[model samples]
Target: MTKEITIDDLKMYRALVETGSVLGKNTVLNIISHAGEAAETILRKQNAIDTLDRIITQQCQAALDATGLHHLIDEDGDGDWSAVWEGLQELADQKRHAERNADTYQKLYEQRAESLEQAERERDEWRGKYDESETARIFGEAQQERVRALHSPEPARYYGTDLNPNRQHDCAGCGEGWAWPCGTIRALDGDPNAAV
Candidate 1:
């Protein structure tokens, strides 16, 4: 077994043949020298192209690996553009899948928000109805008392006031009527002499 000669070795041999003066056969020496020079030039150019190809392949492989598409590399391990294209296609598909999922989630979020808003609106309406019913119950009780007083021989007139036992002062501003403490505060504030 022998080690193969490289372009640099051939070039060094050619230089020695050209510079050496010990050669007796000028013609034979010229022939060998020219052949060596030609081989060296061709081999050098070819080696340069091979090195460039290896660099490009490394760069391409690095890029593909970053995208997590190393499996797309061909069986021969060559730098084939078709393999790179396949990796790119996989990336595009992944991007599209993510976009679709985002759109679906956005729609779901919007639907949930609308549902929550509707529920809140309904709850507010029910609360308002409950408040109205309670107000009506209070007014109905006051009206019943007024009616009972009118029927009694010894009648006690209805005084406008809240039903709290602690506050015995009736609202003189509202007089004898079923009235909320609406104007009483303002009326009391206006009259300095009046008790709140």
Candidate 2:
């Protein structure tokens, strides 16, 4: 195909035409040679660009064919890049949702662990109080038993003749002779009116 002249090429041509009559023959020839060289460079650059574009297109098409992703291309052979962009956005959204759920579960786990620890501490405190009360109860019973043993009654003794006998019972701890039920024994048996 024939190449169209650009504005820059037209301007160069106009400058050459205007200077051709005043310039020497060698100068005119040199100007034309330089113009030709500039045009050749532009053509070479355009050819290289075209070759690179073709190579890239061929490689992209080959990759799509191998991956079986030809549906991502439109009927005009252009890639539907918006579809890929939307898919990436969806994945990012899912990742954000998963991270939020993980944070919620982690908070719940920490709260549960803290609650369990609190319950265990309370249980230990209650157990300690129960042990103290039980020990007090056992010590109180032992002291009560010791008091009962000290104040126990013995057999009655008579210190007179058979006609007029004075009978009295002896205390086991103090060996004192008194009435049948002693004051100390009555007090140990929880009598409120017992005298000591």
Number of the top TM-score candidate: 2
TM-score of each predicted structure versus truth: 0.36, 0.44
lDDT on C-alpha atoms for all candidate structures: 0.66, 0.75
Candidate 1: worst 10 consecutive residues by lDDT?
Answer: 151-160
In model 2, the Cα lDDT at residue 3 comes to 84
Candidate 1 RMSD computed on C-alpha atoms after optimal superposition onto the true structure: 13.8
**In model 2, what lDDT does residue 101 have?**
100
- Clashes (N, CA, C under 3 Å) per candidate: 0, 0
- The total of clashing pairs for model 2 equals 0
**What would the per-residue lDDT of candidate 2 be over residues 126-157, giving only the tens digit for each residue?**
99999999999999989988877767567666
Candidate no. 1 TM-score: 0.36
Superposed by TM-score, candidate 2 places the C-alpha of residue 145 at a distance from the truth, in angstroms, of 2.0
Candidate 1 lDDT, 53-170, residue by residue in tens: 9998777777677576666566677546676766777888989999999999999999999999999999999999999999999998787566444331221243233544333233
